[model samples]
Target: MRTAGLALAGFLAAAPAWAEFTTGDALVIGNARYGETVTAFGPDAVQAVARALRLRGQEVEQLANGGAVAMQQALDGFVAAIDEGETPLIVVLSGQFASVDGGPVLRPAGRETSKAAGLSLAAVLEVLAQSPRRAFLVLGEAGEATALEALEIPEGVTVIRGPAAKVAEFAAREMAQPALPLEKSADWYGLALSGHASDGLAVLTHTEVRPPSEAEQAAARDRIALLDETAWQRAVESGAFQAYLDSYPQGLHAEAALQMRDGAPAISPAKAEASLALDATARREIQRSLTQLGHRTGGIDGIFGPGTRGAITAWQRQSGTDPTGYLDAAQVARLAKEAAQSPAPSAPRPRRASNAVSAQEAATWNMARGERGLRAYLGQYPNGAFAARARVKLSNMQRGSGQ
Candidate 1:
């Protein structure tokens, strides 16, 4: 598939002095060089975008027919630019994403001496970690599906790709729409954003064979509505892309789902060690709340530190709240209430009387059982309607045998 192009529009008002935007700080490394192997898109992508966005003060750079080392140089240049306090710098690569042994390799030009150049997702992540700024990526006819699949990015980055044949068309599509709102749109799998870029509303436009039908539009609305917490939870549990996309497509909640999908690592102790810079009022409030919750978390400490996260997680687990370590608004409110309570030591809820199981519940139970056999069945169906009935029937059978 062809990669998409961006056509970001200028803000009506000049961006604040703090904001910086660079659309063409990109290097195109393949095909277009005179002595390189076959070309994918023309070598003029960098120049073209540079000219288009030059008025906006974006410095465009091109690395034509670059080999592996050349590509590294370009990447180093980009890093240097950002280190020097460049606010917004975008990187676009058009070539082949080859699945070399090192993961996803970028096959730059000069294949005669330079072996297939591959840049794996891990490499990309390293680049991102080097700078605090958000970034965007555009892959134009870069790789096959296998290679493309390996190019994962961290949060605040975007990626877009399609079959090599459609790359030019996709690029055109991206150009017409120029830029989509990073915060508002679903995570751009093939695009990256600069952390301090001006907040212009993203707009995309393109001609298509047909407009979506009314039924299709309604179906989409229904699907989006289904992307509630339940659907998201289900997708995470299943770890299936289809299950995920079925609920949330390219919409507002997609990024959140993707974050979950990307498997956010547990916040490391090192990260947690940094004390939250809380004001006096916040510290006092937290301390008071902790005392009320019957926790001796070593005094409120006036900082949201390891002790606070532990307390919050423990409270959440005990209160049937999602045990995600981070406390959001809803969780915070509930935690505040828990702090006020002098409850019995946290324990599991008493079993309910009703034994009636919904079809949905049954389906989940069956899936669990299939995954973990008797253990799964017992764990999920504990004191459930079926389990309650089975217990009673077993007791009756034992009594009859004794008689």
Candidate 2:
């Protein structure tokens, strides 16, 4: 019953709430219970999927371990609200599934394995048929998709079948970065990707969305960072990213501080690492190696803004791989090896030291992954720009995932 229309704003940052939105709803169901036969399924994966969807401004119907009655009601409600346009739509069904009539039906918890007790998969697929271009059906780990060939799935609706965790990952990691090649993505996650837009289009990220009003744009100013605005502006104007960070490590512009300091675009890399969990040092190394090979990264800093990606694209072209401007593990290794054998194209760029602090606050906030990292951040900089936001985020990540 949660109408999460405006929950897409940056959860942790004191940013405006829901400035843009993809029209439509997502139905996410996770059933971990099946009496004594199956071990109790956790809500973690489903919840993660819901959170990611919400962060992307998708309204989600998150149903956890619903019984027969609950399942029917939720499904009916979600299907009832659908419109057959180019609206973003997602449905994640995770749990035990029963195959009857040579088709799959979602089975309720407990000893009931009968088709009468099962929810028809065709009903869900039928709804998906409406907006094939903007729809996705992720068959999560538990209820393995069986005999899908016989199911006459429509052309546009993408179907991804995989573990619940991977499904969550597709939602969290891949959906937003549609440019990331899906083949490698599916291979890494062991997901069987299909459907209309599955070949290339990032259905969720690519789906058309309504932009916010001018008023909403004006309201994007950080209310929490009012005090730090003057100082932050000074730092940026003087190109003293480090200096400003040094002075106000906990300032509102902490993360932005670092990006401005020496990196490329002020792109935050924490939440959107494109599924490649490279740390600052690792990213810098890649940049460094690329530079040695005459690929300019704009700077040797870790941030992979347009410059770095462009360099990557160049290298990919030379190496005879798809020039995605992105890196995979193999590509990363190859780049490193090539760099080692090749001579230094130019001397290592001197690290810029224009005084720094505020950006560190951002680094702490951006780098913190879970409760432990957040707690550690709080312990070090209790009054940092994102401390309070981190606390609230941990308490409730759905709305409080920090910027």
Q: Which candidate is the best by TM-score?
A: 2
lDDT agreement of model 2 with the native: 0.60
Q: Write the per-residue lDDT of candidate 2 for residues 1-403, one digit (tens) a residue.
A: 1121334445486866543233457787777666544432345656677666655545456655554655675676466445335367788787766667847777765444565666667888888788757777877666455645455577777777776666666766665453465556666788887766445565555332334333322222222132244344445445555544543456555776766566755455321233365766897899888988988765665655555767999999999998867677788899999999998676545322111236776576556765688798888766454444455434433333433
Which is the leading candidate under lDDT?
A: 2
- Model 2, poorest ten-residue lDDT window? 218-227
TM-score of each: 0.36, 0.44
Worst 10 residues of 1 by lDDT: 1-10
Q: How many times do residue backbones clash in model 2?
A: 16
- Would you list the C-alpha lDDT of every candidate in the order shown? 0.44, 0.60
lDDT of 1 by residue, 246-324 (tens): 2235533355555544555644322222123235466547655755665443333343333444666776687787665
